[model samples]
Target chain A: MHADPIGVLTGAHFIDGDHACSEGAIAAGCRFVAGYPITPSTEVVERIAERFPFVGGVFIQMEDEIASSIAIQGAVWGGKKAMTVTSGPGFSLMMEHIGLAAMTETPCVFVDVQRAGPSTGLPTMPAQGDMMQARWGSHGDYQIIAIVPNSPQECFDLTVHAFNLSERYRVPVMMMMDECVGHMIERVVIPSADKIEVHNRKVYDGPKESYRAFETGRDLIPSMVKAGDGYRIHVTGLTHDEKGYPDMSVSAQGKLVQRLMDKIRIHADDIVMYKEEDVEGADVVVVSFGITSRTAIPAIEQARAKGLKVGHLRLVVVWPFPEKRIRELAGKVKSIVVPELNMGQIVYEVERCAAGKCNVVSVPHAGGTVHQPKDILAAIEKSLRGT
Target chain B: MPRNEIKIGGFGGQGVILSGYILGRAASIYDSKYATMIQAFGPEARGSACSAQLIISDEPISYPYIVAPNVMVLMSQEAYSKFTPELAPGGILLTEEDLVVTHNLRADVRHFSIPATRIAEELGKRLVLNIVMLGFATALTNLVGRDAARNAVKVSVPKGTEELNFAAFEKGYEYGLQLLKKEPEKILA
Candidate 1:
């Protein structure tokens, strides 16, 4: 569906990533934002607060991150597209609710503008340390989609895509940004509302008496009904049957959990997104995402200038790990180099996907700032030398 | 220009970041070029020396941060002392004449000074000093065109203040043009 013209601010704006993400959310038909003020990510909610009034949207400054996270889920059930913005410390607080959203198949977006730390570390700096946490932070076997944006333009474009994916799969999607990209300013051209596609959750219009909240067809994704729809629907964190009632049986748990996992796993091929350059016959390929992808370019160029055939694989969607593509490249390339702001989160995933077919090199950073190109270059040279 | 890295620095509320943003908008939006701006954060940026780093080029920018700036716009003495040594050799240095004093300046670089704050006060707002510095930089350096910079200033400033900002820009630009005519050898030096 095309975006609503009232919510879309179509123009050539010189804005930062946080503001761009807010514009993208508005363009994507999101009308509810619940968040607590946090560094870097605060601008996303700040912009939402300023713009929501004009567009008939709601912005609530929740008591804390825990309340903020769950409030968005509540808004979702009230027939509104919703999101919550936070950083590392707040992201940690929202983990249990993220699990709840997955359990109940809530469609929402979580914006984590990552900062340095295990605990409030370097509040104003950049880091990709929450990557593993985004995937595994919420304890569960269920899967979620996470997208990484490298620039303010992507911050706008991919945010719209994030909402679409979340609504399509009925799962929480993570807009994984870092402090650097969140604060960096660039020209972001937001297209007209007619050109943008927005996805809304499917609703159950069947007879209210026959409505089974968790019932689905082959796709394993059930249609949703809001709270005031006068349909009897039970939503719970416990294992639920087709009637959405709590089921304690092991078999019920297996069936419901398996469907939740397969809905994403079976469609992984269609959901995964990435960008590749010169990987056909390259000896070494550099794997990176988010802000690190931009930072790794100069290092890749330096490697190419020294007569080395280096390729680049930048992950637009970081989760689901792009296992198939990494496995395919491992056979052809001699080494894969992974660089990120965190010490080593996504690199291990690369190593697992490589599966010893080729050597995997990880250039790790402690998270206060981005990686130096020379350091990444040295790693590329070392990877090529098999040292 | 193939590529130019510029850094603007001052105290917290001196509009250092806004100056960089205007220049970037001028290059990227108005002039159809590419520009990227990154501002410093944390405790240092609260009240002490803060800075905004920018890069403008004909090609798409791969790396975001500036390695070494070819142009340095210093609006305060603290910013001047902290950022001057990092300026690339043979680069251009623009400073606020009344707020900063230069000593042992680099010989390889050309220096230009403007009383931007005083000029802005004369225009009834001390906040527009950054706009004045922008106009001075536009006239002295070939980084961006005059029309593009003027257009950016027109749209970027708050409503009803565009006239004041434009006047401040014109005063600085006219002052820069006069300086260029008076010291042709110095500019070329």
Candidate 2:
């Protein structure tokens, strides 16, 4: 069923928002997609359901978002790169599973197409309000990878990256996309299959009796064993021991929780991805992501054209947020202008990273649309003057 | 490598964006002029102001949206008023005459007025005016192939509706050719 099993497949054609997202899931070697039909995200599943049958995979429209997320969690354990997409309201329901994926250290991808919302504010309109929620909505102390792509093309490309990051480091990944990016049509080069590096979960080949779900050396990432395998795999939500048994003993629970945190915290650099632009001899740096980044690109050029000596940086990987790079720039640049859809989600990170070396000023707007470049430039110009 | 930046704006359903994709695909896929297209949606998909920016560069282009487009195709009066000022010093603005009937045209910039909505209404669909505008757009700019644009329209149009789309484009192209005949030096000069 794989067409070009060794090389990236090539077929240039026009596709809508939903199908493009599904094609990204397929190219990422996603074997399972569990999602319920909700307006913006429904097309993602509908396309996956239609395409999965032909590609030797499964797509189930679960009863609700909770069931959908749980089914995807099961599929990931069953040795498959699984995904589930949901809109704003549906996403509200899957917050618990999002926390579960993090707590259990399960490697799976979840896509949340951000529609305007607090609670289904506007299903069709786009919003980046999910920016703050994506980082902290899932309760508990756990690090996860969250990427937001601004275009239909980025939607396709980033989903592939989400799967790669999730597998490389055993953890859940979230992809944030909005209606403008999800619904808008664009020309995206469908990558060849061979070009995509597929990573499967590590399995313990030792004696079935000796397999442990949460026991590894200094790295803290353990080898996983499927349920049907001869290895007895007992994975529970409760804080467990290296032997997969819930040990409420202080030392056992403390060791278990610390290791889960250490695995991601130690490898933060490897997981974060960002795009740095025109920092040489610059005063104000504009930090942006998602649809707002598109506008920021032009604003950066305009700032440069106006001789403001400003640069631009974009965070493709929003979680495990690029604190290192931001810290490095905060010292060099006069000020950092963060223009996002929400009031102050990502800006909080920029401010923390700044640590008073440079002021982190935020320019945000939300409701139905994206932040304009002119407003971003205005911020950049203001930052330049203030500095 | 010179990048041909084409800016299009109009109501959403007029296919302003489809024309951008058709032009990009034709030049990049078939004719081999590296192309990139961008569209910013309005809050409302149907009535709000919609725009598509197309770039055809021989070399790799870094920036996606053009701040000052080389060519501007305005489908409505509001689009014309919104975009005409943003055209780079030496740019052209193409407006549909039937709907945007205007006498206060800019003298510094080259302007062509085509009755696209009038032409499409004759073909029994107002949405096809975007195709007619594409005809006028391609005729004015030398970025994309005439044949490739036609093929792109073929791939873009929904099943069985290809013939009407083709006829609409052909009539608009012929209309553009006749309009160019009146002042050949203006376009060529």
**Per-residue lDDT for B29 in model 1?**
95
True contacts kept of 1: 0.85
lDDT of 1 by residue, A82-111 (tens): 999999999999999999999999999999
lDDT top scorer: 1
Could you tell me the TM-score of candidate 1?
0.98
lDDT of 2 by residue, A1-387 (tens): 332352233576455455677887788788798888876667788888877877788988789999998899898888888999998898889889988888777899988888887887887777788877777777776777899887767778788788877887788888898776776555567866766666666778899777778888777788887767777877888888877788888898778777777888888888888887787677888888887887687678888898788877888989888888898998898999998877678998899999999978899887477666788888888886656
Candidate 2's error at A174, in angstroms? 0.8
What lDDT tens digits, residue by residue, belong to model 1 across residues B1-189?
Answer: 677999999999899888999999999999989999998876764568899999999888888889889999999999998999999989899999999998989898889999999999999999999999999999988878999999999999999999999999999999899999987765621
Per-model CA lDDT versus the true structure: 0.93, 0.79
- Backbone clashes (count) for model 1: 0
lDDT of 1 at B139: 90
Candidate 2, Cα interface RMSD = 3.9
- The pairs that clash in candidate 2 are A7-A194, A8-A192, A8-A193, A9-A192, A9-A193
Per-prediction tally of clashes? 0, 5
Which ranges of candidate 1 are over 4 A from the true structure? B44-47, B185-189
